[model samples]
Target: MHSKIFRGIQQEDVQVAADALIAEGLRPTIERVRQKIGRGSPNTVSPMLDNWFAGLSKRLGVANASDEQRLQPPEPVQAAAAMLWQAAMQLAKHAAQEEFLQENQKLDMRRAELQNHEAELISRQEAFNARQIALDETLQLARDQLTAMTSRLEEAGILQARRDREIEELRQQLKSREDERDAELQRRNDDATRHADERLRLEARATANEHRWLTELDRERLEVKRVVSAHIELESRAQATQTQLKTAQAALLDRLNQAERSLKDEHHAHELAKMHILELQSSLDVCRLAYAEIIKSQASQEPKNSRRKPLKQLMRGVTVRRKL
Candidate 1:
């Protein structure tokens, strides 16, 4: 294949250039020839120029090398050489013209292929741009959704915090109530113990009184025959003492029953309070579990920073929306 760059140059163009250079006292060297022709290959131009020079040398008695001996040709050979030179010039020009046309055809085909490639690239770029825009829209929508979910999570957290605070207060109250109940139970026990001691003291006093009455009765029996009036008075005093002992026993029994009932009621109250406290603790545990699940769900939905809307921002949003 010919050089794509220098294919447009013709043989006649090279000859004309060589002749002009010769007139200017410059030898048609390869570099000069290429400069004169504007553009041509050494391979294509060198052979054509060599043939033209050989034909000329055949026409004249001249040596191509400055040191070489010259030889003369016959007039018939000279005339034939001149004719051959003309024919060779015509053939060289024709070949160059055909090659130039072929090169141009190839160039046109290359340009068309490049244009088709450019069009395909442009379509692909447009499709990529559309896809990028779609991706951007989807990303923005996801961000908005994340923000909304974050706000909801924050609100849930706030409610949970309030609930926790309330539960803590209730726990404190329950603790205080338990302390009071324990103190009251201690006081009731002290009272029951005090009453038991008092009952024992009363029983001891009644027994002593019975022993004294028995001793006095034995003495009165011994004196009954000697003093009836004195014996009757002593007997009446013994009956009054017996009645007081029965009254004291009845009062002691009533006090014991009342204390036992009070103890039962207090125990029942303590058991009910314990049940309520246990229920509160159970509900608190459930609330904690539910809150943990919500947090886990939010974390799974998005990245930490992506889903987290700050509390201040959330509050601001709520205020703004309310104002609007």
Candidate 2:
């Protein structure tokens, strides 16, 4: 029922307000129509007022006919009525002109607001395009760096694999050398043992031969004393006894020379045995030095824990050689 309760004034409401103003004997200008309706803008009221004015002549003709049949008006009253009608028409025209100017000003303001909004949208679109280009370039750089890193990682892997293979080959070679050294050490130890036993046997043999030569020399000295006593008692046959003593003395001297030669030969044989023992000892020492060198090389190449067994074996071999 109230115009204020609605979002905007309707055409029917405007018409009603204009008709009411006419009834009150007032010109239906935009402001007068709004004042009657209680709410409406000039832009909305102007068109409605024009429609009402267009039909006003027909309504006036019908009213005038009815009034003539009822009673004729006096002449002065008719003239005043005609003059009021002309004044109302002129006021309506002026109101319409003012409303048209106000509408034109509002239209110009709306067009400017729309143009500003369009410019803001275009600026935002350009900024978005620039940001997208930067993002794409950054992504490409990251991909290139990733590819280079992957290539380096692959190369490092290949180099590591090659080093591992070479280390394995070195280990195999060291193992073979150790085996050969162990066998040679065993052979040398056996030779040393044999030589030691032979030396002991030769020493025992030399001692027995020396004892036998001393006993033979003592018997020859006793025989020479007995022969001298017999020669002194038998002087009546001095010539034959003297001849026999000379022959016995010559045989004793020959036996002494033979025993001396035998002793010298035994001493020479004992010296040869000692020289052999010395040679065997020297050989064992060489073997020990070579084994130590092998151990040193292995220790440097291998882990400490892995070297323990080989070191123990070398120690055992040295102990055996010492005993020999």
- Output the number of the lDDT-best candidate: 1
The Cα error of candidate 2 at residue 168, in Å, is: 2.6
- Give model 2's TM-score versus the native structure: 0.32
The alpha-carbon lDDT assigned to residue 113 of candidate 2 equals 49
What is the per-residue lDDT of model 2 for residues 7-117, given as tens digits with 9 covering 90 to 100?
688878877887787678976676677778888765577656666765666667755657554775677975674455334434433443454455446544544544554
Question: Where does candidate 1 have its weakest 10-residue lDDT segment?
Answer: 298-307
Off by over 4 Å in 1: 1-20, 23-25, 28-76, 160-324
**TM-score of every candidate relative to the true structure:** 0.33, 0.32
- Candidate 1 local accuracy as lDDT? 0.57
